[model samples]
Target: MPETVFEVDVDEDPEDQPDPIVNRWHPDTPPAATIKPGEKVRIECLDWTGGQVNNDDSANDIRDMELSPNHHLSGPFEVKGAEPGDMLVVDILDLGPFPDHEWGFTGIFDLENGGGFLTDHFPEARKTIWELDGVMTHSRHIDDVRFPGCAHPGIIGTAPSHELLEAWNEREQALIDRGPDAQTGVNHETGDDEPPLALPPEPENVLLGDMDDDKLEDAAKEAARTIPPRENAGNCDIKNLGRGSRVYLPVFVEGANFITGDLHFSQGDGEITFCGAIEMAGYIDLKVDIIKNGVEKMGTDHAMFKPGYQDPDFSDYLVFEGYSVDEDGTQHYKNGNVGMRRACLDAIDYLTNFGYTREQGYFLLSTVPIESRLAGVVDLPNTCVTVSVPNEAFDINIDPDTLADDSVVTDRSDVAKPS
Candidate 1:
């Protein structure tokens, strides 16, 4: 079948705007456009800061910007045949910066806010500007490094129905109800300052007083936020989902109301620092299809995926190990957040010894393609976590094509090994 193409650009104009950029991913957010199941879509997205942090923005600008309701998305493009319980197959065909602007930024969250992985060690907020050249990215802060870009939409998912939305809130709220002292292990901070675990009350859609059922329904629709990745897969920031990747998201609402944004030029796993990754404003070319009765057939609750990468370079990595246990013999292994934080701190410590400042090391860790893995969860006293940074990303003179050989090992062979 001949594929139909639809375009949804960022509405920067003051008047006559047909399509608008939406910051929240509520089910009621009207579709910017609609297309058949087999059609293609070219969506233009703003950066995670929604144009607030420009290429020339300073660290203070990043610190001052209102980051709530972030991940400025382009569309909730309705798939003509998609319905609840079906699966939306999104084939990411292409992704990159917009033609006119080929630059992006990376930064770390402040300490006062929900601190980053290495917040206690590197507490200050910082920003780095990255210049994009096709599939390569170079940052002025780290002049000695340049790596091949792996651009992808950090946030991509379908809107949740009212029932599913309520379930998400209730579950998340239950976790929040277990006070900070409770060992819930999940990151409860949803980037909002409201009560009941940052899950804000739904905004009243249009005060339709004197109404009964419609008013309640409107309030329910406004409850879904864009922060957490639920069964509908709102912000699953998996870095490997580049072009040619296929994402399968369980549909909860009719038409699916598929939306995407938070395009990153490059990022590491875990995004340990809240603002980690080269945040970019770019265009995504996607081909969407639907699988009928996908929930029952796939046997999955939320979104699953087959990631694709163009010419993936498999080089040796400088692995840094960490353990989430105190010297007093306490283990925190329920959610893996504590383990991940320790891993990032270890990576930063290793980088500092290589002549980089603590801040520089933290920024580099955030921007580079570092992979954080749970090395051992079954260990009784401590949960082991490993942060692996690719060796090729360093400035050391090495052949890119030959770096994948097993004989080539990272320089830090003498570092403390994981038990």
Candidate 2:
């Protein structure tokens, strides 16, 4: 039987530690933070955006809220003996079910007033409401049926560039000084009025919510004084990262730089909106292992990953492609390949190694499977790409959501084209 070792319902007091930010909601109050190879577990987590917005809450509530940079990652707990380059194998022991009222979620965006996406469509910061009950919907809207709410999160990854904030400030101020960003507009350089802005900085700031003018003014400087995550690893509240899933990350600095916090109970494939599913407070068990230089793709099975809070029946993988430009209007691809077939083939050969008899693999993959993705634009010569595969296709099981990822599953030099 799977062991439920990470559940914490006792609800510890918020003032138990210093840097109160870490204690925003709850820490690893649950005793055991590491599970044995075959043990099943459950973790307690608060909403990804803190208490900014919840189920009973409204879009208006989220619009007028102030959240802190308390990424919900459970622990930097060092895996017994994991070193650099060694893959930390995490198995999804068991996924615990929770009620809809228990979890909350939402997406984060800036407005024209504060530099958000598509400034034209949204003049201000806003989050769309999505469900996480794990239902289904019609294909062409031909039927009135709704899809189940498989609430999960969209941004679960390992802590790689934790030191980036310290190193990348030359242009940080330039962005803030520019005031709010344009969601959609002409990039004078490209002469295209419809291009999207590059990825925004991870700098943290306080949103002027319903607080009194005095309170707002008081919190303004201090909040603004707070530098958003420079590693640019902030604001990822993917739901599939909670219980199981071993996220592989490149080690930029010491300690493998592992940080995670955003939690969701259940989430859909394309979390089109912002936050929902089970964004609640639960316990998290983190195990850290190291991988030698260079963090690469995940396991042999799947799109390298699966969401933490999804159902076994949900077919499809999720991956993302980031877009960006330069002062000279130069564009860069996430990797060097823009070919869909190449990307698809990359995913294919990977799954094939996981034990699929060529025929079954193709049929099953086409039937109900797809890739999960993470979106990133803006940077330099490169962007971010996150691809997710369902657990059904893969032969390996691990927690990329909570545990530290310092493993490199495959060598990049040997990615797609067979040697």
Candidate 3:
């Protein structure tokens, strides 16, 4: 393990500070701290909601929480030798709860706001608290279910370049303009056409240190909200990025301006229900390095440049399958997002059959270390997606014999002799 050179305490206050943590990632936002590559920095991070939710298990705190400038990121730690077009390799050296505060949360967002996987089916706002012990976590809301603690930073990324920020906003706005009905593939009889929420405009005069005149432009300072992950790797809620994992993120600005927050004590893949994922305040020790011209030298495409992890811990899985087709057998292969959504819903439904209610099933799917995998994409009419839950996490006997057969007959014997 590398020795820590710098530390950020999340609870420190500057005598009535307006915002405790930097809320946006931009090149113009001056680096909070700078450390050379290979030097380790330990950051004390707040949960996704900052400090709004307390240990009292308050659901209203989550429901009434402000959404703007969300995911309180710790630092835009400038790597000494890093520059644009390089690959920032962040080693997940260590993760754990902040001193004396061993707790976290999981929940589902209301449908009227930004909805989640099963928003239409389960639209109520809910929350579940998890108590984190040494290497295990147990929730009182969901009885008789406990899992090992797998902690990691949920939001980790570098700031996007000025041009990349514009491109992101333009593309995301186009998708939002398509309206909920068009995107979800469900027709509304009443035609309630609500425009998608616009990305908050970037703040002005936020520059904290000496900056070049060009870098201070409005366009240069502004960036798209950190909701979706892109080539720059912001808000990628991957569960496998725990201790010992190495994540490579493409750098678009000088210093790679690395930032991280939204610490999760444990989270499942897909993060189906948005609100909750064992959210926690913790410390993460990251060892950073830079790979120069990684994009061109590696021939990496845009989508492939997001973030790649290595040497993740693996386990046996109890898998559930979902297809992107209607009950009447109509296939909808065009939209893969909707397909993945259906797969998540199916996984939650399968959990319900095992005595978990619809809400509990959603909560279990979010907090546990489950993974969502695209099983098959080439199947003609219907695309297959599978949610794999680690069998080791639970003590209950989920018999493989009782589950539905996921095998597909590939025999071509019935093809009529080529006419």
Candidate 4:
């Protein structure tokens, strides 16, 4: 009550109690907790796969990977010793870094690795390498651009029902073994090693022969119009994560099922690569606590992202979480656009380091044609939103070495090519 503490996701109904927060899972419903202010909890968000594999990851290993469809969340923990109608506070104080870099390759969205705009097109022929350091090194054709990998939980939410969980587990496994996916070699043998989810071993990207090669190309290209960037657009790596940043999330179901994986060496705003650097497993330390409602007050149950903002001229990097992608995935894109606005606010603040004023930065962002991206969707449990700004637009003016603790914004001036 008087000091900071850590807790887990507890259950309570808002409408039946005092204040209410529209639950994310059951939108028409009310939230369980009415959390109090200044109450914060640390989260130990596990890397996706629940530590199923790590830096020592390998294709052969993936083919043999055995994680019983566990979304691998730290916990949908219950905040005991408390009542309902309160707020659940979470702080992104620290993150675990991947020690090994061998398996820490940048993941591209092709049917091969399960990413890429035309990924489904060349699902069997798309892959890229990445450098897991300060100057995120990557190549596109002959040109290359650099960005930082600011990571977060692609799937963070409350625990789902038994049926939902079971279905997701099956889906996750299917993707990994759907064809020659997690295999080691580039495009080795057929599904002899990894079989399809259901259908027989048909040609690559020729499911049902509905869309021919030409039609597939058109579809891939059209899909590219909205697919997360890659060769079609290349990776949209951003550099907001070098230090000091905090991320907050609302807990819907019990045990706030938090699944953090899909590590990237470095990623731009749009996540064009459809993945991040270092697709290997890693650890994230976070704390989850439930804040009762009637006993507390909250402006909103949404997240308070850290590294607060980025360059205004750059595209907005947005983050979102919600329901099925099939029904409103594109609408989910709309959600990302909103996050972009918040990014603009942060970008304005970031520009301050480069001698740009709130007004000046805002002006630039208003004129900027920000790009949108779909970061990832893990099972039926959780999803993501991505907004990327071009790095070439603004100047990173601050020295990274002297960054202070109070603010998430950084001065880009000190980002020398990692030595």
lDDT of 4 at 337: 37
Task: Estimate TM-scores for all models.
Answer: 0.82, 0.46, 0.82, 0.40
| lDDT of candidate 4 over 349-392, digit per residue (tens) | 66555544343333333222234444555433434444344554
Candidate lDDT (C-alpha), each: 0.69, 0.36, 0.68, 0.34
* lDDT for each residue of candidate 2 in 156-223, tens digit (9 for 90 to 100): 33333323433343355565344433654555456554423222333344332223556544434322
Task: List residue ranges in candidate 4 displaced over 4 A.
Answer: 1-72, 80-85, 100-103, 109-116, 134-144, 160-248, 252-265, 269-280, 287-290, 294-419
Candidate order by TM-score, decreasing, is 1, 3, 2, 4
Question: Whose lDDT is higher: candidate 1's or candidate 2's?
Answer: 1
The root-mean-square deviation over C-alpha atoms between each candidate and the true structure, in angstroms, is 7.5, 15.2, 9.7, 17.7
**Which 10 residues in a row give candidate 4 its minimum summed lDDT?**
224-233
Clashing pairs in 3: 107-276
For candidate 1, lDDT tens digit of each residue in 371-404? 7788888877577788888878877633445445
Q: What tens digits encode model 3's per-residue C-alpha lDDT throughout 1-419?
A: 45543344445532123333556666666776788877787776767666666555456655565666476667777888787877888888788887688988776766665667677776656777888987689876666577886677888888888888778777766765554553553435555644354444455423222345565566434655667777877788887778887878887888888788888888888777886578988788888877788767767623222222432254777777777775455778644566676666776676654556677778888888787777788877667777887766655544466456344221211100101
**Candidate 3 TM-score, true structure as reference:** 0.82
Superposed model 3: Cα runs more than 4 Å off: 1-20, 180-190, 193-221, 301-316, 327-330, 400-419
In model 3, state the lDDT of residue 165: 72
Output candidate 1 Cα RMSD.
7.5
